[model samples]
Target: MLVLGIESSCDETGVAVVEATGPGVPVLRAHALHSQVDMHQAYGGVVPELASRDHIRRVLPLAQDVLARSGCALPDIDVVAYTRGPGLAGALLVGAGVACALGAALGKPVLGVHHLEGHLLSPFLSRDPPEFPFVALLVSGGHTQLMQVDGVGRYALLGETIDDAAGEAFDKSAKLLGLGYPGGPALSRLAEQGDPEAFKLPRPLLHSGDLDFSFAGLKTAVLTQAKKLGDGLEARKADLAAATEAAIVDVLVRKSLAALDASGLQRIVVAGGVGANRRLRAQLDAACGRRGVRVHYPELALCTDNGAMIAMAAAMRLQAGVQEAQPLYAFDVKPRWPLQELAAA
Candidate 1:
């Protein structure tokens, strides 16, 4: 079936068309995205109101682009899927409104997809994919979690950040180092020339023996280090970036392995924006390889928020018959929703 997916859970407005032929088998016909990163860059972070308004402006045009590119008209779209929650309230509503309206107009079914679920299933969109019963490490600006996946729509939260997410920590630390907004990528780029041993950063909750994570302490450690360096610290930026990256990667990798061991899941799937981190990928790849386990990652571009992942997830959910028939105006955005609460369709 052809599914139209809409995503506006964050700064990016995304739309895509996907087709599902069988269980765990989806084909992407076309996808289009509009990122408000530059708009939010001036504010150093996303402004919810601005984000919502932008989504309103872009979602329809993006949908049109997706349909034109895919050569599929409204009638060809069997279902409309949209992100329901765990994001900015206004942002979620934009996608929901458009999707619900489109579905109603087309006399088709609509499904509200969990954003993180889309991230977890993203690796399947790749040529080389991991099967069911795997561990998923979701690391993004707003969240960091480890989940056990037994099947489609079956997820068990194992561990998550108790404070700042790994990406947030990276961005915050980068700001302290004089880097501008969206610091995660900037910090990572600097780390390439950094000496990991130049500065020592704390690995918060590294040995907590639980799935929970804490990066607030690590951010403080970066602040303390910066203060100790005082002036003329520009030369040490790379070293600081490396240390921060290492510390964050260490905790994530260790906790991921622990989750794998606890769940006895040999395959690990990493998702979210931080999943694009070269160092994190390398570390997880090495750790999993050493343990004789397999690791999967979405294509680098797909690691960040995108419509393709949502489209693929929606197609799977539709194929599984996990959908609801609700009025177009009955939509609501969930700013905080747990992944474990979703039932397999």
Candidate 2:
């Protein structure tokens, strides 16, 4: 089966094609992505309306590009998949609308996929794919969660963030440190030059005795520390960034280990944008290595929101017979759909 996937959940517009043969993992034939980071930089964050408009302009061209690169045409598409929700409503609508329109035009079935599920299942596209019954640490844009994934549709939510997620803490703390938009990467780059122990930052809910995470308090602590540094902030920016990254990585790494113990799973898959963090990866690698645990991650290029994950996820679902593509052209998007909801789908 050839699946065409579209992703316009936030500031990035992506499209891709995946081919699923027999019962093996799906392969990403081709993918295209256009980031709105430069466009949203001036505003310090994503403008939903602008994002929606850009998606309108980029989605089709990206789709065409993916098809051409994959040596396929419109008529060859078997399933049209799109990120259904848990994102900006306007952005989600763009992808959903386009996907449905295409499905309707081609008489092909369409599937609405959960954005987080795309992230959770993305690792299968990697060279060293993980097996079932593993833990997943998802630290996407505004979500941080831990889950026990038994299979394609079997997910047990172990814990999640109460307020600000790990990604939010990284971005917000970077903003507090005067880093521009797309702060997480910028902050992480600067952290390479400073001492992570230079500043004392709180590790919120680190001892909560549960898998749940809380990064809001850590952001608050960063703000307070920055305020105190007022005049000296510039000189200490890198140090502060490093400290903030350290604290966030600390919580994520520790909580992930706890989740592994609770689930009795020796393997863990880390996904989403924040999964690209160098500090987090290094820490998780070091920590998990100590316990003889296997850790998996999507290729760095796939760590961010992309169409490949969406297409791969949809292909997997279809292969597992867990979901069927719907012929209905009409659609609705969930800007706040919970990943756990798919457990019952």
Candidate 3:
């Protein structure tokens, strides 16, 4: 089966095609993505209305691009899938509207996928796909969660962030330091030049005896430190960035290991945008390695929001017989849908 997927849950617009043959990992035929980073840079963050408008302009063209690259015709599409929730409502509507429209035109069945599920299942598209029953650490834009994933549709929530997620901590801390838009990467880059121990930072809830994470306190600590260095903030920016990154990484690494121990799962899969951080990957790899645990991550290209993950996730759900593509074109999106909800789907 050939599945075409659309992702417009936020600032990026993505489209892709996947081919599923029999009961195995689906193959990514082709994918295209257009980031709205440049567009949203001036505003310091995503503008929902602007993002929705950009999706309107980019989705179809990206769809055409993916089809051409994959050498597939519109008539060959078997299923049309789209990220239906856990994102900006306007952005979700764009993808949902387009996907349903295409399904209606082609007489193909339509599937509305959970956005976080796309990120969670994305590792299946990697070169070394993980098997069932692994713990997943999702560090996406505003979400930080730990889940026990048994299979395509079997996910149990282990823990999640109560306030700001890890990604938010990075971005918020970066903004406080005068780093421009796309703060996570910017701060990380600056962190490479400074000593992580240069400034003391808090590791929130590091000893809470649970898997849940809290980065809001860390961001607060950063803000306080930044203010204390008001006169010489520019001179100490790199050191502060490094210290903040170290604090966040320390909590994550320790908590992940704790989760692994608690679940007794030897394998863990890291997904979502923050999973792309080199520091996080390095720390997790080293820590998990020492504990005789295996760590898996989506390819760098798939780290961010993308249609490939959505398509792969939809195909997997069908293969697992947990869900079905419906002929009904009417759809609604859940901007706050939880990943655990799919456990009952």
Candidate 4:
């Protein structure tokens, strides 16, 4: 079946076509994406209203590009899948509106996919993928969670952040150091030349013995250090970046290992934007390798929000016999939705 997936849950608008032959076999025909990173760069963060308007402008053209590139017309699509919730309401509505309209016009079925579910399944799109019954660490700007995945649509939330997400902390700390928006990548780049031992940053709740994480205090620590630096801040930026990165990586790796031991799962799937952190990946890879476990990640391009994951997720849901909503079905976005509440179709 040919599935058209639309993702506009956040700053990027993505559209893709995926073909699912059966349970474990899926092919990506084509995908297109439009990122609003530069658009919001001036603001130092995403402005919800601007993001929604941009999605309205780009979603259609992107869809057209994907369809044309894939040699598939609107009518050729069997299912229209869209990210339904867990994002900015206006952003979600843009994708939902376009998808539902297209589905209705083409007489195709439409399925509302959970945003994080798409992230969780993204690793499978790779040639080398992990099987079911794995641990998933979903670390993004808005969320940080540890989950146990037994199958598609089956997830058990083990723990999550009690405060700001790791990615948010990274961005916030970067901002304090005079780095601009989307600080994860920018700060990490600076950390390469930084001396990790130059500054000692606290690893909050590292030995909490629970899966839950807390980076709020760590971010505050960076603020305090920045204030103390006074006029010498410029010279110490890299050192601060390195210390922040090390502190975060340490907590994440330790918590991930603890989760693996608790779940007794040998395979770990790291998803969401923060999964693209090179340091985190390196640390997790080493830890997992030492314990005879494995780690999986989406391609770097797919690490953030993209339509390919949504398309692949929709294909999997269709293969699992998930049902589509009615043609007249219209629902608002969910700014806060629990993953465990998602039901199999």
Task: Give me the runs in candidate 2 sitting further than 4 Å from their true place.
Answer: none
How many clashes show up per model?
Answer: 0, 0, 0, 0
Better of 3 and 4 by TM-score: 3
* Cα shift from native, residue 210, model 1 (Å): 1.2
Model 3: lDDT equals: 0.94
Clashes of 4: 0
Q: What is the TM-score of candidate 1?
A: 0.97
lDDT of 3 by residue, 201-274 (tens): 88999999999999999999999999999899999999999999999989988888888888889999999998
lDDT string for model 4 (145-235, tens) is 9999998787899989999889988999999999998788899999998998898889988988789999999999999999999999999
Query: Would you list the clashing residue pairs of candidate 1?
Result: none
Best by lDDT: 2
Off by over 4 Å in 3: none
Question: How do the residues 1-345 of candidate 1 rate in per-residue lDDT, one tens digit apiece?
Answer: 888899999899999999877665898889888989899899988899999999999999999999999998988988888999889998998898888888888888788889999999999888788798899999977799999988778788998988899999999999999888788999999999999889878888887779999999999999999998888578788998899999999999999999998998789999999999999999989888998999999988788888888888877766666655444546777889988888775
Those runs of model 4 whose alpha carbons end farther than 4 Å from true positions after fitting are 322-328
Cα error of candidate 4 at position 270, Å: 0.5
